[model samples]
Target: MQDITDVAKRLVQHNKGKITEVYFVACGGSLVDMYVSDYFIRSESTTITSGWYTANEFVHATPKRLGKNSVVIACSHGGNTPETVEAARIAKAAGAQTVGLTYNDKADLLAVSDYSFLYEWGDETRVHNNPMAIMLELTVGMVNELEGYDHYNTFMEGMKLIDTIVASAEKQVEPRAKAFADAYKDEEMFYVMASGASYGHAYGFSICSLMEMQWLDATAVHTGEFFHGPLEITDENTPFILAMGLGRTRELDERVLKFLKRYAKKIEVVDAKELGLDMIDDSVSEYFNPVLFYSVLSKYRYALSKVHNHDLDVRRYMGKVEY
Candidate 1:
């Protein structure tokens, strides 16, 4: 993780002001790409064009939507999945400079990219996506000229703050994740509520999308559309996770918190202000919580996977695929 961030700083130094804005084309694992793009938005002037596609349709559907003056940022944990690699190929043929971020050194994803960031973990670390997302956050920070912290030393210090919060989170993670998972586990459907930068939380919602691929149990809803009515009807078996959000409208977040406590069956908060990091307050300002979110979120999912008898590395089955 340290080396990935350091290399990213160099990439940012190298690419500083070279382009007008970055276009982050995210695909592959949902939370990983979502947080990476969130970090990019903080680091640079960026626009995200989703790179996801139905594997069969991507070949004909991509290309015209991508091209010069853009960078295709692809995330593939395995590094060599057929659809992701082929999507990277389409991204390149359209004249965009491609960069592959992944855990392996050599794979078809790297083959199609002009540049790559390799994290060296062949599978998601500890069967959660934190290691990969951390690398992506550092990559975005590095490429954005490292705006907030002038020295990498300061960034390391900030990470230490995150580590401290993570320790406390370890004590509470299981209970919180299980509370939501147990409620959600039996549901045929549900919604995830997120808005603003926290809207990136929807990436986790994609567990339902890929669950068909990996066959996990997940259902979710967005926060805004949810509160319009259903907020009053939830029970223990159906719950909502509040990415209560941050920034100028913090008063609104307070309201949401109150409403969740009153109307919803349960509420779980990934409080940016509580992460025991220098960035905690800043997580609210910059939505920098994604990096913090990844570490803690990874643990939550790990606990739930155990209770459900699902593979920890749900994206990879029994270590069968190697890149």
Candidate 2:
């Protein structure tokens, strides 16, 4: 397997000044993973435009900005997501530079991309190994190269402390995960809330873990939009899981938290600030908060699985039938 770092360096070197926009294409967990990358590039770069899109949408309504100077990044965990593969093919045909990241080297998406990075992760048990961090580093590394951010190396150095951080986060979330699982293992429904960097965690956890893995009904609602419609559905008995991160957007999450406290009877807040990320440098903590926040909250999946007597790998329609 090629080191993703080497592929990242090559990608940065080849397209440093030529690329104008980044189009992230994928579906489901793959799409959610790229959200942080899209957010990071837009937050840091002055000239570069970045957007993440679901594969099917990207195919039907291709962005006008996508062209030879754009970079399209496509990823699929199984490497066989039909829409993602087609999206990569379309992007490549449009003369855009295409990069593929997936756990499977043989994935159809890789075949259509210009450069590919394959990393082996068995059964996807560890959230830290989800490739979101690697893709985030790659996108940020490009920003550092082009915009003189110069934080890429420092961020990479800080990432060396990730194991320590994840361990601490795990310890903190373990009790909460168990507590939530013990309380709501048999509950009929759940709604997750997050905003900004932590939003992907909420979306991914609600759909991937709760709905798909645990076979439960779950909805992911952005905190900023909670009051627009979702808030009305809240009641004393409604279960709300809030994944909060420390960043400029923390205030948005806090607003939702305040309302949930006032109305909802069961509000479980998994705060990234509560986790020991003091080991991480303040300069990069905000950018990496999603990784940290999700690393902790992913524990709840396991706890819920165990408490509910459902195996996390159990699925009904994912691989069982054609969609």
Highest-scoring model, TM-score: 2
Which lDDT value does model 1 have at 285?
Answer: 41
Which structure among the candidates has the greatest lDDT? 2
Q: After superposing candidate 2 on the true structure, give the runs of residues whose Cα lies further than 4 Å from its correct spot.
A: 1-9, 12-16, 122-129
Question: What is the C-alpha lDDT profile of model 1 across 1-323, one tens digit per residue?
Answer: 23555545544455443433343444435333455454445543443333334433555566455666455566676787676677678867876666676677766788897777665352233312344445445444544453444334544445545555656655666577777566555544444555555555545644633263325444444555555775656765554555554454345556666777765665567665555434444433434455555556665566556656676545554346765
RMSD of each: 5.4, 2.3
Q: C-alpha displacement of 54 in model 1, angstroms?
A: 8.1
Candidate 2 per-residue lDDT, tens place, 240-288, comes to 9888877778898899999988888999988777786656676677667
Pairs in clash, predicted candidate 1? 191-220, 191-221, 192-220, 192-221, 193-222, 193-223, 194-223
- The TM-score values for the models, in the order shown, are 0.69, 0.91
User: What local distance difference test score does each model get?
Assistant: 0.54, 0.81
TM-score of 2: 0.91
- Lowest summed lDDT over 10 consecutive residues: which window, candidate 2? 119-128
